[model samples]
Each structure stands twice: as structure tokens, then as C-alpha cells.
Target: MNERAPATSPEVLAAGYARCAQVTREHGTTYYWGARLLPEQSRRHVHAVYTLARLADDIVDLAGPDPGPATAAALDAFEASFWDAVDTGTSPDPVMAAVATTVRECGIDDECFTRFFGAMRTDLTRRTYDTWGDLLGYMDGSAAVIGEMMLPVLRPGTDAVAPARALGLAFQLTNFLRDVGEDLDRGRVYLPQEDLRRFGADPHARVVTPEWRALMAFEIERNRRLYREADDGIPALPGASRRCVATARVLYARILERIEAADYDVFASRARVPTVRKAALAARMVTSREPMRLVHRDRAALDPLGGTWVSDDPVVLLDDTGSPVGQAPKSAIHHDDTPLHLAFSCYVLDPAGRLLVTTRAASKPSFPGVVTNTVCGHPRPGEDLAEAVRRRARSELGVEVHDLRLVLPGFRYRAEMNGLVEHELCPVFVGWADGDAVAPDPAEVDDVQWVPWEEFRDDVLAGRRTVSPWATEQVPLLAGLGPDPRAWPAGARDALPPAAALGPAAEAA
Candidate 1:
């Protein structure tokens, strides 16, 4: 558990947030645990906003003694008072006080609050939505606005809003899926009526019938797509904020897994992710090398180290023909055991035209302590080879490369070291470093040094230095081309092997 050291603030603001934070922790277990991944300053603000939303929600749904009209009137009054307090920069109500402080401090837009309350007002009268678009209209205000509100705390790029909106809708839809039975008990069905009819599902059919199962599966797939779309924007955020959002995304999405585990019997039992599992997931993020990688895999290509080095991370599994047949956890790939896959080797050169070389960390499973090119990486499913080269350079060496040129597209190799095999139809790239200093990530490289290209070639040829078998063939071939990368012979740039040509013959060669 992360401990927050007490710091003094304006008494009213601090007291307001303290109360809101407690409310957040007590009710929203999954969100509370995920928010804990954020820095205390941002975390408190998130709690305050969530508390404000939760309070309004309670007024609409949990004002038990009041009828619908009374509840609606109460909600309207609460909104009016909350906004008035926000405008005046003070609120006697504890929740509003926290909300005011958070909005002012984080520079949140009042328009976001306007949109959120609009959705809350809808819940009063709307019993059933007719189409997917209508539900989306409802969620735009209800769910998407929440994502918009939190963007300031997350601090992602301006382009982040679209994905943030998708993620919010995904989270809200997951709740709808999990709470189907509970929602029914409250005389409501959150799933769109049109979708229900399209799938031959009857809202009144309380049992998990086959039609209902099919419908749930369809909706689950839809939600998964939304989650993927939302995940694309997470990396644009700051590091800690990315982790916090990623943590929340993974844990919340796991509820769908729970529902599936129970055979889509969300009605019989509400899918709940336990607090212990939530803690373990958060702990895993802390220990994992690339914590910024989000819950979704397709969007993970943008993450520098998302698919490399880490065993459980997924890599594109290619058939002998170099076409992506599927993906496998990287840990599952072993020497000669798994089919040959597509990979890329990148070499970086300083302004002086010196090539960077790195020793594989001793802890690496294969070729440990062997020297290699600046870095080697496997492209995620559908990732471009040149893009992968640049990604690995940044992740492993903490350096950026410009104008990566695929110098040897037909490069392929198969070598066995210790018990593991090295077989790849790997493309070779050359890129100039953006700066002189190379900061090596210790997990990936044991040591890094820049050596003149000619000197490195001579050392490798003379057996004065140990190099990975792929590099053994590659470095000398690169040296044959010459000193200036831009001036390298055009003949050296072979066309990449077509998918059909990457067969066992290439592997055995």
C-alpha cells in the first residue's frame, strides 16, 4: 500500500477532499485501487471527482423513500447547488467543496460537468433506449464526459480525448454487463432494446438461455473493441498516469472475464474482481519492465518494450512463410522448438559514424552476455519492421533514431546457443542517433559502447570480440557496404523475402 505523508492545505479544501477520498475508497473498490497507482496529488483529485459523481448517482438511484418524481427533483436541486458552489469558489457541502477545489486546481472545464449532469437527468425519464446510437448519445454525457473530466489529471496529448471517451464508454458498458441482474431488480435494462431484439434475446428471460448467451457474447465483443480503441491513447499520457489508467483498464476489463468464466450468467451472480487480485495486478505493474503498456494488445505496438524481452508479452507468431498465423506469448518461443518468426535487428550510429554495440544482459535466457547490434526486437502483430527497430532503440538504449533505413531486408539466420535456438527472418536497419549520449537500460543491455565502424568490423573478424551469431554474419556484411550509411551501395538493399519464401529452407540455411 502506498502511504501519503500529510501535507497542510487550506483547511476547507483539505477536509473536503479527505471526506471525498474516504467515500471513494469505501464504495468504488476497483476504481479506488486503480487510482492508488497515480501520484497522491492527482489521485486525490480523481477521488474528488469520482465522489461527486457517486454522490449524484446515489441521489438518483438510492434515494429509496422518494418516488421517481421526488428523486428527479432532488437530483435537479443537487445539480443547481453543486454548480452554484463551483461558480462561487466555495461550498458548505463537503462533496461540493472537494469538487470545487479539484476543478479549480486542475483547471477542469465546467462544460464537462454540464455534460455529466445532462446524462444524470436522462436517467430520470429514460427507461429504454431504442438504438445503439441512442445509447451512445446517453453515454456521451454520462460516461464520456467523465473521461473528459479526468484528462487534466492524466495529462495526455490533445489527441487523447477520442480514446478517453471510448475507454469511458467501455468501462460503463462493462458495468452494464456485470450488473444486468441488479439493474433488472431496479426495473431497468441498460442493454439497448434494439440489440436485444437483434440477438433474439428477451429482457424478461431471467435465465441464461442460449439466445441470451449469444447476445451477451456479442456485447462482450463490442465492449472489448471499445477497450482496445481506448487503450490506444494511454501511452500518450505521462508515465504514472499511464500506469494508473492501464491498471484500471486491466482490472475493470477482467470483470468481463469473470462473467465469461461463469458462462455469461451475469444475472445469477454479479462478476466481482476481488481486492487481493486487484492488489496483485497493481503489484505486477510495479514489477513489470514496461508498466506503461496498457491492457489491450493490438494498441500495444506503440509501447517501446511491450512485446520484447518479457516472456508473457505477446509477439507475432509467424509460420515458416513469415506470415502472421497467430501470436504466442514470448516466453513460449524456444530455440528450434517454435516455428521461425519475423524479427528485426537495428544498428545505431553516432554523428561520428561509430556504431553502438551492446552486451546482452547476463540474465537473458539465451545468448546471455553475447554482444549484439544496438538492439534486436520482434514486431508485434501487424507492426512495421522499421517502426519496431526505432521502438527497441528507444526502449533498450533510451535513444531515438531518425530516418531508419532498411539496409538488408533479406537478412535471415539460424544458430543454436546453449539449449536455445536463434532463428529469424530478421530485417536489418541503420539509423543515426539523435544525440551523442546513449543511456542504456540495464535490463536489456549489460554494457554499451560506441566504436568506429571499421574497428568493430575488424574486431569481429579477428575473433577478438564475442558477438551474437546473427551479428557475426550481420556486422561484417554491413562493413562491406562502407562508412557512410546514406552512401551505402544500392545493391545491398535486397527486397524483403515474401511470406511464401520464408520457409524451412530459409530456417535451415
Candidate 2:
């Protein structure tokens, strides 16, 4: 007999649900209303798609200032990895995994996902469409694919592709008209150029002119026609699915009505459908069931699986504590030469109360991964020596120790590693780790281990350990603290070092 567990873990499923629910509440009020009409299983899947899509949108839209290059690269990587996960049925990225589950469960067309990326890519560079055809092409990739993807989930084998595509385009175009001014402020223009030209309007010019009004009226009617065409396919959808689509259509359509009511003055201010109106639309959709015929149109050119786009390198998922199975420390040295002035040190302590010290990684740019004292750092501006040690210890070794009394402050050391000059004022602290396990965040410490204090001092003195300049300078001072210096290792023993052991110049240097 063979044993098996569930295909997806409960934790993963819960995470997916929470992510989707949060994103839906943030971005998809109307769509969320439609989602309620779905069966529980299908509803979960819809939310998953919404979560993934919203994340993708944020990568381009909300990432920091000057995000164009970074956003573009990230999107390309995400899209490539997304398709790879779909093809292979596994993904390291959580968002992609959720989307893959939705894809597999819903039997959605893969092209819809590709088109979504295509729309996102368009947002990266294109601000205006040259013609109605151009605008439709953008919508096909941006919005139509969403409907196509959902259709499979709503009705497994329905042939309503034509109607879904039309509806998606109609909804998207309406959104463009409504958000024209807002988009323009962000340096984007979604209105079709040919229509602008036809109405003697310049999209780049100010809003609310005679020409703009004419163009708005023309575009609104065009969307209304597309909406009518899309309605024809609604009855063809499964009963539950039709109502959901109807609610979305009616809700979006009101935006166009709002534009008209505003006297086609989208340039002065964008149009929006109020919540009360949206409620009315939802109610009307629930009571109405009209079957309209959809007219099929010539299809646009499909996007090719374009260039060989590279996805991001796989992320190694770790537990909440940031540990991976069988992981080992990666050694490297830190030297400060760059504008950021970055440097770091690691303290290795074992369960036997010994500290293991090693040279930094040879590949590092700073100290070339130099061997260093138990703790090290660059004294940040406005940070005293004691404060710096606390921050570095906690951040590098995940050991939060307080009562950091500085044994020696103002001890300056200099060394050159990998063409970078390292100048540091060594401030040594004796602190105690209160039974806290060391959890090294990889971006800093590479390896750590505890070794006997006597052994560590001998290794440094004998040159067996390639100690950093600061560490080399501090070892003798640390050793002189007691008969068995290991017994007083920094944070452990409470008694302070005798004040007479060092001159004021050495102590305060």
C-alpha cells in the first residue's frame, strides 16, 4: 500500500486566501462583489488570480522613484518564471505558486496570463495609443485576457471566448476614459490619437475643450457598443457565472454614464461612479436576465512567446526563523570604499563557550573577507561606539545583548583589502547573550562558531587566524582582562575591568 498527503498544504492555502482577500479588498470592490457569486472553490481561485495580478501591478506602479528600469526587469523575470512554473507544476515564489494552483484548477488558457504581462509591459513605456485599433490592442492584452482566463473557471468547456474578449475590452476602455486626467498627471495618456485628431484635439493640450468633448462622446459610445456586443455572450455563460459578469458590466458601464453626466469634461476632472450607483447596478443585475446576441469581430494579432526572457533566480524558502536545512556559512570579507561605507564582522561562539574566528571570504570587496574580532562595524554618523556594537551584534549574529560596557574606545586601525581602504575606530564591548541562539541574517555574517578563549588568543598571536586589524589590536587587551579571560568573555562576567590597567589616552582613544 502507498500513502499520500494532500496536494497543497493547509498553510499554503491559507496564505493564498489571505493574500487574495487583502488584495481584493484593496483593489477590487466590484470584482469582489462578483466573486461572491462563485462556488467556494472557484471563489478561492479567483481571489488567487486577483492577488497575483495586483502584486504584478504594484511592482510597476508602486515600487520607488525611478522604478522604470527595475520594474521592467522584475516584470520580465516574473513573467518568465510564471510560465516556467505553469509548465513544470512547481514554483518557489509563493505568489506564482498560488497562481499556478488557480491555473491548474480553473483550466484557464495560459495566453491570458501572458497578455496580462503584455499589458503591464505596455504601462512601462507607452503613454498613448495611436488609434482605436491601438487602444484595442492594449486592452486585449490588459483586460480581455482576464475575462478569458476567468471564463474557463466559470464554465469548464464553454466557447464564449468571443464575448468575453469583447466585454473585457469594453470595460478596460471605459476605465481609460474615466482615469484620463489622473493618468495624464502620471505622464500617461490612454486616449486614441486618431480619435483626438478626428475631433481636432491635442491630447497633450489642456483638458475640457470642444474637441475633447467630441472625442469623449465618440469614445463613450464606442465602449457602449462593445458592451452591447459583450452582453450577447452573457446568457451563454453558466447561470451563476452570468450574474457575476453582469454585475461587473453594469458596474463599469455606469462610469461611462458618469462621464457623459460630467458633460464630457474628463480633462478638467476624471469621472467616477458613486457607491450608491454601484449598489443600484448590482441590484438591477440580480433582478435582470436579458439574453443579447454577441457579434464576433476579426481577431487582432496574438503576442508571440517573444524573446528568451529570463526570470529571477530561484529563492530558497526558509522557515520563519530564516534557517534552511543543511545550510552552511558563506565566508567573505568587508572593506569600506564604496559611497555606502559598508563593513562588518562576525563572532563565532560554540555551545562549549569557545569562539571560532576565521578570515573573511577572499571574494569580498571590503576586507576580502578578513578575519576579525568577536564584533566589528563602521561607527555610523551620530552613533557612539557602544551603540554601534549593540546594533552590529544583534543584526549580524541575531544576539541581542545589553549592558555593553566599552573596555577600549577610540583605538584606530587601518588596513587595505581588495583595493579598498578600511579605517576603523575600535570600540570593544563586553556583553552577555542571555541564552539566545545565534541566528545569522545572511546579508551580513557568513559563518560563526564558539571556541575556547585561550585557543582564540593563541591563534591570533600565532598568526594561525588571519585576524582583522581591529581584532588583532583588541585580542591582547581582551586577554589581559583576567587569569582566564574566557571566563569573562564580554557580556558574561559582571565585574568591570580595573580602571588603572590603561592610560586615559589608550582608554579614550
Candidate 3:
């Protein structure tokens, strides 16, 4: 719902909105890219919301390490002044004028602002968070409230309070993870102290030790869970609003990817999505209805296949520790927010060490017709992943034999193809075919080739042969294992995902 413009003059509101847009662009490019997909009216409201939050943050932070008496007083005054504008429905301050207009037009709840300011005030006194819960208490105001504030502007078809708040928390957590080093320098550490002790990680050292990596990996998993929770609210949003949120969510989550690529090193430099990519994503969201034509879930376009709490071919659900919590059917598991599950990928090689490349059947539902590794399939609940690899190899490609060893035991990725996601903790295995003969399954692999493993790896690295997203990442790491796949060092059974229980078939490894 929208209301008539506040009595604020058109020239004044436009200038205020223009300033707000600049602030969003300068400080929050991901947000700007997402809002670019919104209609002009909603976009303006987003700018106003961001403007108020950003300026308030500036009031709290611009004083740097020495936020003396004036800083708290200034923050309180800014908060009071914003409310005054909201109360009068007008303001002499240009940005405040636009922001107040948005508050009136969008019917944003005043309580959100109450929590938000309260959190900002807490920041002035509180420096370290003792546990995840403690940090969440502060984020409830500093971050999650931002989502509630945006709900009125988003105008979801259904009430999306929980997911929106989760999305806000996810975004802020991502920020905390990416800015850990910066925060530490500022006499604050957003990471939970309990988690630090549990992992035996000392962020104060600012080194990428194994313990630090473990801690970061755990935190990243928790962050992704929030993103998954937020995905439920996406379908409830319509048109450009949905596009806006989806683009922003995708872009923001990518920062975690960058952090990983940098070996979870936040101290060296800020990990970020290049501005060019953000613009390209924004353009794609604006131009194409499906964006990537990979993960389409537009409610008006297609009704999703209904899922149940229970599953027939169950996928072992995992907690943040990568341990199974329960199960959901393979058929019912995947959607926009596919849960991370246990899966295995097998890269088959012929006697000559030539890699077996397979093209997925064109008629398949997800990632149809994509060329990828020899076999990729999920482990049945309680089934061994090594056995799953062998089963998929025989069933999908009709070839497999010796050297069944895990190569990338920690291989995990999130990818979308043909409207479904393959979010899995997929351990990769390398095996050699016993014989040269092959029979590709018409239902799974319609075509197959035996490319020299070196040539395939080089082509993948050089962008000559575009395969699956997993393949794109796997090639480089596999190359580092050895020049020849036949001689690569074998991975031990202890490295498999916690849910992938070892069975007799896996004992062969």
C-alpha cells in the first residue's frame, strides 16, 4: 500500500532521494543492485530506509576509536530528529524529509526504529559479544530490524516477518564474518567467544590457522542456514520486489564465497564481490525474468512441486556440524533453498588415465544436458558415500572399477540448474574403469567421452570447455593433486562427511 506524497516539495524530496541513492551506492552496492530491480516508488522507499540507517551508522561510527562524549549525544540527537520528522511528516533536512515521507507512505511500524536505535546505543557501550546468543541480541536491533523496516516497502503477498528478519540477520552475519579483522582492530570482535574457545581459534593472532578455518567454516554454515530460511519468503513476494530481494541475497551470499576463496583470510584485505559483477547481476535481474535461466521459481510462472516433511528416498539432513539431524526425500528436498546434504561425485578415468566426461540427458529436470564429471549422486540415508559413488557410476555410466579413493573430501558447493539447486557436501572420488567398453544410460547420461585428463583439466581452467559449476571449481584443485589422475595421492576414509556412514562397499576403498 502507498499513500499520497508528504507535503514536502517535489524538488526537495527528489534531492533527498538522490542523496540517499548516492549513499546506498557508495556504502552498500549489493543493496543498490537489488533495489535497482524495484519499481521507482518502492526503490525510493528502499533508498530512504537505507539512508536513515546509513546516516545513523555514520553518526555512531564516524568518530572512529575515539567516539567520546559527543558521539553518543550526536546519535541520540539524530534518532530524535528522525522521529521528529516522522511526527511532523516533513523536515528541513533533505534526507530526513524523504525518509519521513517513506515512513508515512509505507506504514512502517515505529517499534522497529525503537529496537534499531536501542541496538545502536548498545554499540556505544558494548564491545565484545560472549556467545552467539549475545551477538544475536545486538543483531536483533542492529541488523534484523532492518528487514522488518523493509517489509512495508516490499509488500509481500503474505506476511513475511520471520523470513525477512532472518534475511536481515543473515546479511549482518555475513558482514560480521567479512569484517572480523576490521572489527577486531576497532576493539570489537563479533565472533562468539564460546565458538572461539570451542574451535581453539585466536582471531587476535590474525592468522589463517586450521582452527581459524574450522571456526570460519562453522560460522559460514550458520550464515547459510539463515539464507535458506529467508528463501521461504521469496515466493511470497511478487514481481520486482521478489527480483530485488533475490538479487541482493545472491550477491550478499557471494561474499562468503570470496572469503572461502581467500582461505578465510579476512585480515589481508576485505573480500568483496567486484563492482562489475554486482552491476552485471543487477542488469541480468532487470533484463531476464529467470535471471540465469537456472533457478526459476516465479510463483506466477510455475507452481512448485509440493513437498512433505517426510521423504521416500530420504536425504540425510545436516546440522551446522555436518551431522545428520533427520532426513527428507530426495525428490522433495530441493527448491530455491536446497538444504545441504550428503552426496558424492566420481570422476572416472580409462586405463590410459583419460577422464570420462558425461553429458546429462536433455530430458532430465535439473541441470539438464550439462556436461560434468562421470557421476554425481546423493547417498541414501545411512548409505556409504563411496558405495554411492560406485552405484552411480555403474547405473549412470556403466563403468567403474579400481582406485576408488576420495580426492576432495571437503568438496561442497551450492549451484542451480534448470530450476533446482544442488547444495551438497559432495566428496569427490577418482576411479578407473576396469574395461574400455561403456554403455551410457539413456535416462541419465545421453553422451560420453574420454578426454585426456590433462587436456580436460586445462580446458576447464582456460574456460574452453564450460561444464558444471562444480566441475569449474574441481578442475583446479584436482590439478593440484597431481599432473596425472592415476598417480594422485589417495584420501582416507576419515575425511568423508559425518553423515556418510562406512559400509562394506566403502571398505573396498
Summarize candidate 2's per-residue lDDT along 1-509 as a digit string, tens digits: 01122255557756767778768866776677677666778777778777777778778766533457878999888888777666655566655667777787666777678778988888887777887678778888777887788777778345788888888888788878887766766677788777677679876676578878777766775676567667667778776677677777766777777788888777777576566765665565556554121112111111111111111112122232222222111111121121112222334344455664544434344454555655665433333445555676776567775544445433445664423355433335555455537776555556766667678888887888767776877787767766453354443221222111222221122
The C-alpha stretches of model 3 lying farther than 4 A from their native spots are 1-5, 291-509
Q: Rank the candidates by lDDT, best first.
A: 3, 1, 2
Candidate 1 Cα outliers beyond 4 Å, as residue runs: 1-9, 63-67, 292-509
Tens digit of per-residue lDDT, candidate 1, span 458-507: 89989998788999999778877786666664323326644312211111
Error of 1 at 212 (Å): 0.6
What is the TM-score ranking, best to worst? 3, 1, 2
Q: Model 3: which residue pairs collide?
A: none
Q: Residue 482: error of model 2 in Å?
A: 99
| Candidates 1 and 2 compared by TM-score, better number | 1
RMSD of 2: 24.9
lDDT of 3 by residue, 234-340 (tens): 88888799889988888898898899999999999999999999888778778776542412332211323322212246778877557888898775467545778
Residue 382 local lDDT, model 2: 30
Q: Give Cα-based local distance difference scores for all models.
A: 0.76, 0.60, 0.82
TM-score of 3: 0.60
320 Cα displacement, candidate 1 (Å): 42
